[model samples]
Target: MYALNDIVEMKKQHPCGANEWKIIRMGADIKIECQNCGHVVMLSRREFEKKMKKVLKKADSDK
Candidate 1:
């Protein structure tokens, strides 16, 4: 299961040319932020599940 502050890769590319996002919040709904463009979007867990390709990496202290 995903948690807050996890970095994941999505199946689709962002308009800003980034495919990475940081999960900011998680519950029935989730909030994710684009790494390159600084955009934020909210999605349901089901939606996120469908869109996510794979998790690149989780957020670490160095990130």
Candidate 2:
């Protein structure tokens, strides 16, 4: 399962030209940050699950 502070890859690239995102928060809703332009966005867990391609990095123990 994905957790906060995890780096994930999406199927499509963002407008800023990055496909990498960092999970900043989790729960009923999820927050993700773009690695390229420092953009932040919120999405539902189900929506995130549908678009998530893979987990590139796992969260740290303290994150």
Candidate 3:
């Protein structure tokens, strides 16, 4: 599972050769930004779940 601001690893490496992605937006569609190239991609929740390998860093909650 993933949440906003969480760093995650995708099952496939991005074209930029990065596997790390940061969750920037969430809803029915999830938006992720590549940590290496600043490229953003939005995928449906289902697709995101299927592509997401693991959450590397969970977002810290303020409260």
Worst 10 residues of 3 by lDDT: 54-63
Tell me each candidate's RMSD, in Å, in order: 1.7, 2.0, 2.1
Can you give the lDDT of residue 52 in candidate 2?
A: 93
Ranking of all candidate structures by their TM-score, best first: 3, 2, 1
lDDT of each: 0.88, 0.91, 0.93
- Model 2: runs farther than 4 Å from truth? 61-63
* lDDT top scorer: 3
- Which of candidates 2 and 3 reaches a greater TM-score? 3
lDDT (10s digit) by residue, model 3, range 1-63: 678999999999999999999999999999999999999999999999999999998888534
Give the deviation of candidate 1 from the true structure as CA RMSD: 1.7
> Please, what are the lDDT tens digits per residue for candidate 2 over residues 1-63?
788898999888899999999999899999999999999989999999999999998877545
> How much is the lDDT of residue 28 in candidate 2?
92
